[model samples]
Target: MKLVKVLCALVLVLMLGQQTVFAAAPAPTPAKANEHSSTMKVTFYSDSLHKEMQLNVYLPPNYDAQEKYPVLYVLHSYKLNEDHWFDTLKMKEQADALIASKKITPMIIVAPRIENSFGVNSSKELGYEEGSGNPGDPGVLNKGMYEDYITKDVITYIDTHFKTIQSRNSRYIGGTSMGGFAALHIGLSNPLLFSKVGGHAPALFVGDMWAPLKNLVYPTDEIRKHNDPLLLAASQKLNKQSIYLDCGDQDDFIAATKQLDKVLKMKKTKSYEFHVIEGGHHDDAYWSSQMENYLMFYGATDHH
Candidate 1:
């Protein structure tokens, strides 16, 4: 059944090819269409990580510092940093157009640099010493306390610095692939902090299949117990969270995403949406194409 879906998606992609939207960074400085969003590149200190981190914020056009707005925190895919959303995906330009045309409400987009930490903090077992290596391996300084870095430092920074709504319902979190998996874990774990959680092409661990991530992110069954989305959904109540889960039919993670959707439905969360995008794959092309849908969900739709 999944193979059939992939084949169908391939056919659709061939039939109606949408130009891939990811481009080189700095995005060629989009031509001013009308009133456009103001962009800010910020670098701030993360007490949790004990280092300075960077993020991209896109403020809505005609942004009034006094006017509070909702904030959407987007996580990029694996290997790629926050620049994937701002530069590669040209999210600022897209958001400007969407808000200018009133297709979606004006809001703030915050894309942070989360490297390969899998959106979680490092284990104390790993040396906190600064070293050069990939995560989960010896002699790697992947930064300790990533979960705290994001959940505490990042959130506190955004709220304190920006004109945000400053409420759980006004804050949103979503991501692609590894970032998606992290968003799911974090959002479910801290339901009072976010009312909406979206996972796009999330790299989920099914059952008994442990690969690369296990060595670093989920080293033990006990660690997986807390971070796994399936376990979290089964154990935690998502009653106050509006969840969005999507993947391309051709993507390998579709099956896992579907399973998560099933679990969320069984739990009878506040809301749930599972989308298998046609002609979509687990690549930037698919994610870039779905930006409109993503924006609509985050900006225009009513979570209540």
Candidate 2:
């Protein structure tokens, strides 16, 4: 009986020792290739909208805490959320490829959800300040002061949390469709915030669209006047560099983009590139094809 009791005690001790050894083992290192690039979703409170908002940030493959990086704010389409560019379009993959190949500079890309706010300080008449619609909802909501949310809240959050090259020259903004329109509006209206602007298939509209817009979001004529990129360009409000406008030749908005291009040329803007690509349409494939161009435009600078 004593011998059996001793043997049982020894077994228990050995098992406990093995468990301790395993517990003390260090975690396995993540693969180096996997460490090169990463994406993170972050949420923060937006004083502009009095709500908590979320955004996805893409860190370059070589992102380093000790180094500062240029930032590009990529807005999403009207119906899509922030992840549209990162997930659906695989924009982060394209960015990773460009950065790894040294075709473009390594930079951080921020995609913020703006819903149908159009990134404008819309009119009080539109009820963008008193509704209960969520971020990606198609209806109007009072919590959709997206311009303020983006320019102030989102930008501030990123700059505070990340090692960013904090300067207008180091920042760029771009988007598609309604997002494209908002990108132009935000960049042009706040030139000191973004040095470069790229509008892909921009939804540039005239007064005829305002009547329909009222039911959609209720924008006052004054808000429309301020958000119009063409008017801003003609009025000399667009003061950013390398403002590129690209649209598919077959895109319905091609005519408006062309007119804007002409206006910019007539204004003799120092740095603007307008291109109507062949066999291009207002769709994901077309935008995806132009991703390289967009990356080049934003990352082809000395800062990059």
Candidate 3:
């Protein structure tokens, strides 16, 4: 009987030891797929333009509405709709990767469709001149007032509907090509609205003739001075906000962008950064490659 009791005790000891070992093992980290980021197609009425505007919003992985996140407004290139940023660039995937790795602070991305309005309140007609008119081409038609729609209407909608840090410091704006131009123009025009503005391969206007298509936008020298990014930078109209400008070496806008850089340098603006990346061009591959750089710049900080 004593021998039998000893064997049973040994079994209990072994069982307890195994239980301790199992309890000490750490749990595996959650997979990124389990917390995959999500995209929502949202449409809201814009009182500014007197119409409903479509927007694509990206919520970071494992997003919780109770938690507030900073917002980055990324404008699409002219003629391209809001989906171009996410569809062509795979921006949500990139954003998820950065956020999951903690390379960038988790934030929301908002891409609003502007109907090729150049992101401006061009003339009284308010909207882009579609049909027959190419981007940067003259003889265009006006449809709606987009600048107010984006800055005033869309922003208001996001702030009211989502848990967003609705402050200039938490707000960032960026785009490629004409969207870049719009970013520079709108971002600079409202200094108190955006903390950082990035222009990726911006289609900056050096003169009216540089882009015959832009005549449809600027239409006149006075309007050009007021709306053109180059002119705004030259005249030192840019507010005291962080400015980021980069263009491809092979991009046709390089010369004009360089001129803008020179003017910014001459103005002694120390809060701006300009780069001429090698083998870069005004194309999808080029923009896609720069997404990391753009996110790092925009998401570099978590505070104002």
What TM-score would every model get versus the actual structure?
Answer: 0.81, 0.80, 0.81
Quote the positional error of residue 225 for candidate 2 in Å.
2.7
| Candidate 1 residue runs with Cα over 4 Å from true position | 1-35, 124-143, 207-212, 301-304
Which pairs of residues collide in candidate 2?
36-61, 128-142, 129-142, 130-142
lDDT of each: 0.80, 0.81, 0.81
Error of 3 at 211 (Å): 8.0
Supply candidate 3's per-residue lDDT for 163. Answer: 84
Query: Mind sharing the TM-score for model 1?
Result: 0.81
Decide which is better by lDDT, 1 or 3.
3
Q: What tens digits encode model 3's per-residue C-alpha lDDT throughout 156-205? A: 99999988998998899999887898898888777788988999998776
lDDT head-to-head 1 vs 2, winner:
2
- Give candidate 2 misplaced runs (Cα > 4 Å): 1-34, 123-143, 210-221, 237-240, 268-270, 301-304
What digit string (tens of lDDT, one per residue) describes model 1 on residues 1-304? 9999999999888666543333323457765542556777899998887779999888887776337999999887776888898787777778877776678888989999887767876653323333345455532435367778789999999999989999998999998898898898888888989999999889897865544456556768787777888889998978888888899999988888888888888986787888888878888888888888788778873431
Model 1 steric clash pairs: 121-146
lDDT of 3 at 122: 67
Could you tell me which residue pairs clash in candidate 3?
126-144, 127-143, 127-144, 129-141, 136-213, 136-214, 137-213
- Measured by TM-score, how close is model 2 to the native structure? 0.80
